[model samples]
Target: MLSGRLVKWMLLLSEYTITYELAKAVKGQAVVNFLAAHPVPDNETISDDFPYEQVMMIEPLNLWQMYFDGASKISGTGARVIFITPQGDLLPYSFTLVIGVYDHTPNYTRSPEEYPSAANSGRLLKGKVAIITGGARGIGAATAKLFALNGAHVIIADILDDLGPTLADSIDGRYIHCDVGRESDVESAVNLALAWRGQLDIMFSNAGVAGPFGSITNLDMDKMKDLLDVNICGMVHGIKHAARAMIRGKRGSIICTSSSAAIMGGLASHAYSLSKEAVLGLARSTACELGVHGIRVNCISPHGVPSEMLVTAYRNFFGKADMGPEEVGRIVGETGSLLRGRSASMEDVAQAALFLASDDAGFITAHNLIVDGGFTSAFSTMSFIYQ
Candidate 1:
């Protein structure tokens, strides 16, 4: 019976193999006919998701903007350049681009630090009060501005005294100095939020560190512990006090920042992964505990967001302390996503936080909204080194 079953399986495989080849041929022919009928449009309105893209052209290189830092140019040290590919993907010149045709010189333009948004009016979280940890810059600052733009009263909470107050002032929001690693700071921030608005509508625990980025074998327990304290305990503190403040209102949204490292190993440093994974566990635990109080607890796990945190991580990883943020950004953005032509940005992650904070995600809880552009799901078959 086993032999018979094997024979049957072999027959099935033979039929499938034949069918697969036939299907491929038919699909190829169809794509050829379709493209033959269609004319290639210009840059202003060209679509990339076309069929039979086994062959590509130079239009891609034409779109990219090359930039070298002013300091590097003055130093005359070979003049390194970062390529902003397709208005989104930042790819370093050294990085391989398998465009099926290919290839760059130099063209400096506006940085991709600016992002377009879907929420224009201050209506999504209108009248809602929010505490955004790490709101001084990067994803946190972007979320704060987006939140304020969408009508939420944003409190920029961070240890960055210089930038935090400025960001809050720009948005007409308040700024609170919070280390996040300290429960007291978190509690105080929550209290301040409640004191200002009489209720806490949202708590976005977005602050995190890269944390001693190198081999797991070469690690310091003390440094690891500190990373965990900031990444895990910080999230816990936010959930705790936010829950306390939220229970009063009987409805609040709590958003925690995890990393792609938590979901996929070697995507980040050992200490960072340990910290972020703990964040997920804490997020799950707090979500279950706080759900009873009508609070939605969720995590946004971004993959290689081009922030100062990641910049430092890459600097450590590549052993290039002299590497600037632009180069770091290009390096990350290149490998960030499985979605071709699209790279996850600070604004993208911020928008996700905003969604979780708003009434839109009222029913979403105990959820991990992975902002990886399907990377963790699809990025497979690596030897899995300790990042």
Candidate 2:
């Protein structure tokens, strides 16, 4: 029995989740002039230092992409966000925004070019500082270079006094001697990182060690303990100290280096695989704990990289002390990798580290990025059946 005009009004009001009682006459809205800066009687005054206090506002969405604000009810309008003081005075979003007391996640996006033009996504870590453990060689070293190239102040933390300092110098970075296996060393690295830039934004827990070829039946408990000390315990120490440093800023990214051996069996010694697998668990658990503090934890698992670690492991396993890295790389590319003709490289792992460290991956946490060319996701090729 409703008229079309009344039905149209109902639809319009429903858009705002508002309801009105029938039998009540429509009311007019009152406009209150708000003072930008003034003291209440016997109370402290407030003011805004943030620029451009206006009717238009910008806010970041849930993790990715820019939050384009839509037209909404204005301050002192029908729709409002309000707060009551102990003295029972009313405060709206506009009032606090005007006074610079609105503490929001986007408020932390104070960086220039935070909202860049459509042509670019902006610099990934333009004002950020990063620390890379095991940064003297291999994947850690590669990532350290990439991080610096992308505008982060890089810290190369490693036990290699000679190589670490040289690499740091090459990238205009600072070198700190740090063995992730030692808690004090890791703690010192984080402290040094904070000292250099007044903030620690990224921590790459890329330090690890491998064990020689052995089955679980022939497991060397002593060697297993040693590898665990470097691989598993080391990553945990990085996470522990990194979290302490990150908690102060209320935001950070921590990346751990695991391996495809963690996903596949018979690929590595029992101890190495066990330690890498343990990293996945550690990243996920700490991610859950530190996510509330805006800190992210993730792992990068690259399969069959031709790094010296794998080369040495292969040399010991096959009793080919004379074999070179290229030969071993070719063997892995042909036999183990699904993507034929191309062996994985340390740079590939470094690129994965870059993505996880950037704001482009803001919502990514507790993730295991397998840069394996589909090695772990498939069964063996079994080409004899096709032949």
Candidate 3:
């Protein structure tokens, strides 16, 4: 019964009404202003004190080249990385960045030109002799590689007979099978290093385990004793022999690996935390006594590095054996990290060891370098603001 002319008129009237009402509503809404394209220089806040204008003096993207960078949604204020690629260039693509997130510039382009003909020409621990405990894996292994690359004659001491010898051969260093928990074994390892190189300049004691994770109500006393033997007695044995050699030379650097669990509870089981704290106390007391002989003793407390032992713990807890280190690091970083940018790596702990061993830390001694990236620095109150 409806006419074609009437249907067309109704459709046109409905369209007009919607358009008018939408326009009116849009006009009545409040206007929003956006920030400037560039960052404003503010000296009042520490984070904003950088001279952004000077640092951002970058060339515009050119033909066959592009640069893209942005802020992360979580932190909202971190480093911006850029990549530039040339057309038809696959193998020789060069990367250059003006600034990094840590306020250091990327030396990718300049490194090659600045390097000498030899790789280990200008090394930090050149011509030094170093001994690293647990050098077959984890932080100790990384530090051994670093020390060898830096021109140090390294000795990899570990109970892992196969891996220890293999790593030693690869790095052109020597290996000795000696359990650190046994005083005699530790002494033999130190003596072997001394006999080979005639002196010991650096000793890195970095071996630990997270004892059986269980409630205190059902504590395993035997396992707890074993944990103390390896974590606490191990360091005592290392220091006993290492200090003897260092005292003969009247100069040395002795480093130990502790844990952030030492300072902050609940990060690890009771035995692990207690043993790590004992390491700090041992370092302090040893430093006092060793200072008279020109010997330096220090410790590094790293947080949540997913080594083999840590991975085993993770797998056992979650019933997932295939979980990777990156995933565990991501989870730990989310909870403990104050920077919220990157997770703790084995290399981070190794680098701390390197600093303590090198001449750069000559005046530093008896200090416990807590390398948790500010985790212990903040309390529960800080979670409300950053988390």
The CA lDDT of each predicted structure is 0.68, 0.70, 0.69
C-alpha root-mean-square deviation, each candidate: 19.8, 17.6, 19.8
What's the ranking of the predictions by lDDT, best on top? 2, 3, 1
Clashing pairs in 3: none
lDDT comparing candidate 2 with the true structure: 0.70
Among all windows of 10 consecutive residues in model 3, the one with the lowest summed lDDT is: 3-12
lDDT of 1: 0.68
Provide the TM-score for each candidate, comma-separated: 0.66, 0.69, 0.68
Model 1 clashing residue pairs (backbone): 122-150, 122-151
Per-residue lDDT over 166-239 for candidate 3, one digit per residue giving the tens place of the 0 to 100 score: 88886679999878878898899899988998999999988777886778888899999988888999999999
- Give the per-residue lDDT digits (tens) of candidate 2, residues 232-317: 99999999999999999999999999989889887777788889999999999999999999999999998988889888878987
Q: What is the lDDT of residue 62 in candidate 2?
A: 24
Tens-place lDDT per residue, model 1, 13-114, is: 222232342234333221211001111112222233322222222111221222232212111011111223444432211111111111222122323222
